[model samples]
Target chain A: MKRAFGVMNQHKVMNDQDVRRALARISHEILERNKGTDDLIMVGLYTRGVTIAQRLSENIQKFEGTIVPVESLDISLYRDDVQLRIAQPIKPTTLAADISGMKVVLVDDVLFTGRSIRASMDSLQDFGRAKEIQLAVLVDRGHRELPLRADYVGKNIPTSLEEQVRVRLIETDGTDDVVIVRSGDGNNSNG
Target chain B: MTLLLSGLGMVITLMVDVESNVIGSQNVNAAGTNRKHILDVDVLSEDEILNILDQTDAMSEVLRRDIKKVPALRGRVIVTLFYEASTRTRISFEEAGKILSADVINMSSSGSSVDKGESLLNTGLTLQAMGVDVIVVRHPYSGAPNLLAKHLPKVSIINAGDGLHAHPTQALLDAYTVRSKLGSLKGLKIVIVGDVLHSRVARSAIWAFTKLGAEIVLSGPNTLMPVGLNLVDGRANVLPPVSVQPDLDDAIRGADVVMALRLQNERQNGGYLPSLREYIRRWQITKDRLSSASKEVLVMHPGPMNEGIEISTEVAHGGRSLIEEQVTNGVALRMALLYQVSAGGYQIEEEHPNGQ
Candidate 1:
């Protein structure tokens, strides 16, 4: 799928196998942190985040023999920069499982600036009160604007302001790779 | 020369961006574009209608939440300027505005300055002066909302129902309801039965459904069909074929959606129709009549329904009926419209100093 922004030349940071291994490790880490996935419900931010959450749930199922419920979270309305962008089409936020008194794990693809995660956190309040909230991300690029950190991370690629980090999943983009895009080369091909 | 021109272009882009930010902070429409007035379905293209419905779908999810409210329109003032008596349309608009955390005030013609023979133009001007950001209008006369739009260009005007002209939101909600049930409107046969002559709902529905690629069959008695009804077409030929099927049974045949319009009791006294008894006998949407329609055909009614008059009670409350769903979607659809109107604008705790 096409990334939202313009891309220049791309460098593969993680391939298909690398993504699978990272997710498996993250799932294990989540189970370890939460003490075996009981009362754990996973909520994925829209687009790629939901897919990552599903993958984490499947891994949890495989390891703990427990089905972790996953729900999609759409934070388009809750974004702070809503007035700066062109009309943000509202997306469906579906949570079939109640998060009340359960440990809610928020999953996403690449965490940069942490604005989307912040908005997701604000939106999660309306669903129900979770016992605790945890953030899980596939890649954590260090540009934290809101003093937020993910509890789980797949990989951390250091990047500058001019670079764009994109995590492509097989379900959405028909490819499984994490790439860093450097600008000005005009290599604008989609991920 | 190329380098110099590119440098100039960058400077111009920066200037424009800065200019837009300064002005955008004043008017909400600066960030996004949405027409201030929605007087008719023709104002929205097929894509625009579809987008609003898509937004409505998202808004529907908000209804499912524990706290079914949003701060999207907080501090905005929405006035339901209703000239005619209404339950669904007025309450729906009010609920929608409240759901978005907007300060909504209600104004009906009966108890308001309108009863004193104050002109609509004057009433609209007064409301505009009162810092009303948007006016959801439902007037007995057709084109009242259009007049409000023409006179009050600053305040957003939404046509709730204006005489026989249009009930655009009803159409939108109905279309949303239909699409939710049938999945897609394209190539679907929608038979609109009863009182098409006097229904703004029917007119608006035709405009909306036709634009979305549904074939329309208008079914009613000759007296109840609009004059020059044959001329009815999608605003810009953005619609599929529209035909009049006087016979209700034939109209419903192979139909994917069977929409029953409310039969006005006033039409009987007006001599536009012979009698309510005769009308119901000939046109009531019974189970047997609907049997000829597609097996999975959906039923609908814009309510305050003369249940046994235009539609059989069973059919109105039947499993195939989307009547209640339409009411629910009505709130979401209006909320979507309000959100769209306020999209580019900044939310404020107080009225804009320059608000008209």
Candidate 2:
């Protein structure tokens, strides 16, 4: 029934077990690079990034026996395309603990245009200056408009601008997988 | 000439269809409106009112933060042009614009060119020539903001208060304060005490609260009550049923919220009331009069309160009073309005289909 809608072209790049393995590996990579969560804090972009940050925090607690605090940041108010597009709903950006003198790790589900990360960086400065800032992503699809690269990456999937990479987690989308969707008509009408 | 008129009509219809197609293709935010001015709450739909309230929740969060500022409206210029005297409304608008990082300029009739016999249109043209983004206007005549909105097609106009016509932001903040405390406005009995004829706040509230599914009861002297509130200002929109009770004690019975309107002393010279002492003896919102309502009934007053005349001093500062929070929510509500109107594009310059 689903194939009747021409959805057959979409396929999963990473399954549930593959996603678990990738996240566990990224958890170790974050710990190994930062040398054990001392002044480290995980700041998640809104929606999917928040769930990813919570999973990473839980994995770190399971392995290292210390729970790192996770903060959620909404960057809609800091977007550069305010006039070009429809207004996006502004969500609450809450930071309970100070980010000053701390190693901040920004986490997200996927990195594509890199504009959101630029807005996030601008939003983070208003709270306080961090000692160091690093980027971590579950999937790194390769068209970046800004000069930014993730310090820790789960998977590198190179594709054309017409293709879309969607990461679905059980906490948000009721599944844990990464899928790539390609337009059947080759016109990229939606973009 | 008839042929030419019909030809023009066809062209206008085709243009409207093409414009709608463009908007549909872009998937523009339908939650936002193309309204360039907020002169009154009578024209607002239910969805538009709810959207403003929802956005005010986000703005309130920013107000509670340590920074209390955002760059959402950075570089936008807002000018307050007041022909009437106001302290809270003017300051609230200025602070709201400043919090959104917009530069706010204040101009009053005493200092500006209005004292030198300059008309409102000329002043509006001067501001438009200087490229101001918005003009917050308060005038002593009704429909003053409507005049500015009709003339200044590029700039957004917000009516702070215009005679006895409307004070939309006050009504929005009142709805916000009530909804924040009591959960929902549906089926809530909101009894408005004291003057209803000369109150812009009460006028705006009647439209807003009724549209949100609340039952409104007006209580005051008969001379201070408007004749037909259901068709207020002879506006075409038929409002929900609103009852007017002359006896204050009967109005307070079993009410969920009681909002007291200020009795303007100027109304005395017009023979609207007998005297201040007589008005207070009958209409003042005293403690005994309040206990007739439910124990959980909330009290509100759109200030500069008359302590002994309209409401007692203890009740004004009492636990049930939401006066202070109303001032705070006023800033947030104005921020939401400023951001929405400026971002939601100006009104499309097209005549109505029916040609009213």
- Positional deviation of A72 in candidate 1, in angstroms? 0.6
Candidate maximizing TM-score: 2
Instruction: Please report how far candidate 1 places residue A57 from its true position, in Å.
Output: 2.0
- DockQ-based CAPRI category assigned to the predicted complex of candidate 1: acceptable
CA deviation > 4 Å runs, candidate 2: A1-5, A8-12, A181-191, B1-35, B228-238, B344-356
DockQ of each: 0.26, 0.36
Model 2 C-alpha lDDT per residue in residues B1-356, reported as the tens digit of each score: 23212222111110111122322222123444534567777667777788788888888877887677778778788999999889999999999999988899999999778989999999999999898989999998887787787678677889999887789999999998999998889999999987887788998898789878898888877777665433222333233457877777777899999999988868856777767777788789888998999899898999989888888998899998999999999999998888876674423444111111
lDDT of all predictions:
0.78, 0.79
Could you say which candidate leads in lDDT?
2
| Candidate 2 lDDT score relative to the true structure | 0.79
Residue range B1-356, candidate 1, lDDT tens digits: 23212222111110111122332233334323455567667546687789899999999998878788767777789999888889999999999999987899999888888889999999999999988889999887776776776567568888899877788999999999999888879999998888877788887898799889998888777667665432211222122246777767677899999998887767768876666777787689999998999999999999988878888899989998888999999999998888777555443323221322
